[model samples]
Target: MEHSIFVMCILAVLSIALANPIFQDFSQLKAVENANKVLQLVDQEVLSNHKLGQQSSLPQKIDWREKGYVTNVKDQGQCASCWAFASAATMEGQLFNKTNNLITLSEQNLLDCAKSYNDKGCAGGWMSHAFKYIRDNGIEADGTYPYTATKQECSFNEANSVGTLQNYVKLTKTTEEEILKAVANHGPVGVYVYMSSLFMGYKSGIFEDDSCTETPNHAVTVVGYVNTPQDQYWIIKNSFSKSWGEDGYMRMKMNKNVCGITYRLYYPIV
Candidate 1:
């Protein structure tokens, strides 16, 4: 009976693997085996809904980069630092939208300092925790703290902080329209999504993997959205360097909650 159960499990894994054509070979991903380890970093409590005012009107299409509020793509390297990257990116967008200055905040600051508040640095972390750390202690500038792509001893200097969050809000899960309105009115928002094998191999085009899981894992930033005649997609900024995806950006199918992109959305108010 045990042997039969083991065979069934293997078959289940194989079936799912065959269903995904985008990433047939898991080896193509840099840290394929560690993908789950990376994704499991998000704190579930942060996924709760928070009361936020609804936007009266939002543009059909909005791009934070074109509006001059987003920073460049960052690389987390071999480390599972998506939480830190997303946090810093969202904060940078908030600061830019408010002050009109594109200042690069320090992901390393969160990777190190935030570990005290249930953050695991490179191993994994929640963006909510990172936001809380920034709100309480403030985050330093990238130039001041710099990113090492690995966990290090906390060396946060409040004196070098160039950005700080007044507060953050957790958007309603699976509410893509609400998330769209938030991103359009505010700046870029930090979001958590299930990183499928196909997502790891995504190169270009609108990503709509039917085989992808809905469980949230990896942290990313939603910068904007574009609506076309045939399809609508969200412009997501990833922390996998400029070489990955469409120059470190992925166009995910909008309104379907693709990979749970709307699941645990958050943005900082600078």
Candidate 2:
């Protein structure tokens, strides 16, 4: 009898732990499900608009040399440090454009080290959190500290790298209006918004609306925007484990009705 009671208690504890709202908030889940519905409607809208062929020319591609290349980081499983991935991608683009140096910086470094700033490397964080760290104390290249995909203590060194970053901008808000404006004016915008299981490992094609938005779980970059006759679409780059989707890219509808935007870029004051 005692053994049976203990076994039942263990199962009950596991069930409750799995049902915890922090791990999966029911309200947010409803929101994402609703957003997915909106996205599905947008899909039909896109099909109708496609009949026109090139309704909106691709927003002017940022002069790779002048502006910056918006890219995504490969998702690190359940590692919550999407904050590190987003932050490093932004820096990689800025550094490349400003110095023309194609150096893969260390997202793992931030993931492991940058903790004092309310960041839980693998647990996820806000883009602003990473940028603030950069502003307060700059960063280094992938060669400097390297990526380990594990958390550690930050050891920032200013002199170990070549060339400090310049002409980098971090947007204030993650609103669709703000992001579209930036995409229209600049080359590509880095953003960090919630993604659903459908978004996980997504490779190519347009992201159809799916009812799943409770947890904004991924980090991606907005490369371009289009105002189709039917609806607006954002050209996005994902960091899935592999290079998928239009050669490692995907399109997301800027459903103002659904909370989508996460981060934007503010042009550096030259």
Candidate 3:
């Protein structure tokens, strides 16, 4: 029940109009105090939500890229369209899961063509809306419709399409544990995070920000997770090019829903 109060208080603090004295006073201090709440509360063994009897069968770690289930991380350039990259990564994972052939889908197709589906081209977009687009219009191969990272004319050719979504899964009312389970069981999942100034300066290490506000400005893919004797974290594939983070990836500090990672998490079905 202590954890429950913390969660409730934190959520309440997020409100702009909440007149609670704690919200008005010592907000920054309170944020720091709750920084490691998830780390202290969550049992590391429940990382994958495995059944007790089947614990032995669970893999010690999971990184989809190591198994060829993930494609090379691509750059989104100056565009604020990491959402497209996140959605494409999720589709690529789902495609590989079905066909066993790793094929890169076209994020350009979504950028240029999916504006009607609630996409804003280089400005931004949502993964769920992109999935709806693939369901109705299908997605082309990256080779046929490569990413320019800028808004361009929609020249999508259905003949060159290689993947179509049968459906997509969006988990609601989720927690940090549920997000971890989704990444472990469902492969790479689409998740967004706040691109705080501190987060942008991330060079390496399990990234955790005590001052980060619960606001997500960028979308990325959760590739896998690991729990060692020393520490635990989630491996995330970013769209900021291979030079950023750990070769185009970030090992997000797990169990804290750092940067609102738990919200806007979804996976495509192909």
Report the lDDT tens digits of candidate 2 across residue range 1-270. Answer: 544543343343345436654323222322322232232211011111111112244443332323446443465444555556656665666566666665666676667556776666654555555655666666777778776656777776777543343334554344665565555654444675555434543556667545543333345666666676665667765654545566656667666523245433433211
2 or 3, greater by lDDT: 3
The better-scoring model by TM-score among 1 and 2 is 1
The TM-score values for the models, in the order shown, are 0.83, 0.64, 0.78
Q: Which structure among the candidates has the greatest TM-score?
A: 1
Arrange candidates, best TM-score first.
1, 3, 2
lDDT minimum window of 10 residues, candidate 2: 43-52
Weakest lDDT window of 10 consecutive positions for candidate 1: 26-35
Instruction: Determine which window of 10 residues in candidate 3 has minimal summed lDDT.
Output: 43-52
Q: Local error of candidate 3 at 262, Å?
A: 0.9
Q: What is the lDDT of residue 169 in candidate 2?
A: 55
User: TM-score: which is higher, 1 or 3?
Assistant: 1
lDDT per residue for candidate 3 within 57-78, as digits (tens), equals 4454799898778999798776
Indicate the TM-score of model 2.
0.64
Clashing pairs in 1: none
